[model samples]
Target: MNTITANQLKTRGVSIIQDNLLKDQELVITVRGKEKFVVMDMKHYNYLRECELDAALHQAKADYQSENYITETVDAHIKRIKQ
Candidate 1:
C-alpha cells in the first residue's frame, strides 16, 4: 500500500496524486498515525461501486430463486442493522 503521512500531504499533495496515477494505485492518507482516508482514481471508484451493485443484485436473485427470505417490520430491521 502507498501511504502518505498528513505532513507529506500538506506539502506534496499534487505530486503524490500524480505519482500514483501512473500505476493506477490507491493512496492511503494517514492522520495522527492512523489511516484516515483513501485516494483512488474516479474510474476505480466507479468500478467498485458497480461491483457492489452487481453483487447485491446477484444476492437478491439467488434469494428469490431459493425463496430465502425473512419477514420483519421496518423498525425491527432498523434495530438489526443498528446492532
Candidate 2:
C-alpha cells in the first residue's frame, strides 16, 4: 500500500489523483500518522460497484428460487390467483 501525508495529498491532490488514475494504483492518505482515506482509479471503483451489484443480484435470485411464492410466469401465476 502506498501512503501519503494529508498535507502532501492536499497540496498535490491533482498529481496524486493523476498517478493513481493513470496507473490504477491505490493511494492511502494518512492524517496525523494515522490512515484516513483511500483513493482508487475510476475503473476499479466501477468494477467494484458492478461486482457488488452482481453479488446482490445473485443472492436475490437465489432467494427467489428458494421461495415458494415466486412463480415462473407472472401471467400464469395471476390466472391461478384469480381462479
Candidate 3:
C-alpha cells in the first residue's frame, strides 16, 4: 500500500493518486494524521465485492446444511418482516 496525506491530496488531487497507483495496487489517505480512507482501482474493488458475495453465499449454504432457515408463505414472510 502507498500512503498520501490529506493535505498532499488536496494540493495534488487525482494526479497524485494516479502516480501512486501506478506503483502500488492501493493507497491509504490520511486525514488529520489518522488513516481515513483507502483508494483502489475499479478492478480491485470489483474483485473484493465478488469475494464478499462469495463468502455470503458460502455462509448461506452452510446455514442451509444446518437446517437454520425457515420456509414460509409470501404473506407470512412479509408479516414476519413487519414485526
Candidate 4:
C-alpha cells in the first residue's frame, strides 16, 4: 500500500494523489502519525461497491435456499419486530 502524510497532501495537493494512483490502485492517508483515510479512483470505488452488493446478494440467495427466512403479512412483520 502507498502512504502519504497529511502534511504532504496539504503541501502537494491532488496531483500527488493522481501521480501515486497511476502506480497503485489505492493510497492511504495518514494524519498525526495514524492511518486515517483512503483514496481511490472513482471507478475503482464503484467496482468495489458493486462487488460488496454482489456478495450480499449471494449470501441472501444462500439463506433463501437454506429456508432461513420467514413469510408474514406486513402488519405481522412489524408487530414481531416491535416485540
Name the weakest run of 10 consecutive residues (lDDT summed) in model 4. Answer: 16-25
**Residue range 25-51, candidate 1, lDDT tens digits:** 688889999999989888889999999
Q: Candidate 2 versus the native: TM-score?
A: 0.67
Q: Relative to the true structure, how large is the alpha-carbon lDDT of every model?
A: 0.87, 0.81, 0.97, 0.97
lDDT of 4: 0.97
**By summed lDDT, which 10 consecutive residues of candidate 3 come out lowest?**
24-33
- lDDT for model 3, on a 0 to 1 scale? 0.97
Candidate scoring better on TM-score of 1 and 3: 3
Ranking by TM-score: 4, 3, 1, 2
For model 3, what is the alpha-carbon lDDT of residue 75? 98
TM-scores for all candidates: the values are 0.75, 0.67, 0.85, 0.89
Encode model 4's per-residue lDDT on 8-63: one tens digit a residue: 99999999999899999999999999999999999999999999999999999999
TM-score of 4: 0.89
lDDT of 3 by residue, 1-83 (tens): 89999999999999999999999989999999899999999998999999999999999999999999989999999999999
Regions more than 4 Å wrong, model 2 = 20-24, 68-83
lDDT of 1 at 57: 100
In angstroms, how far off is 21's CA in candidate 3?
1.0
| Model 3: number of backbone collisions | 0
Regions of model 1 farther than 4 Å from truth: 70-83
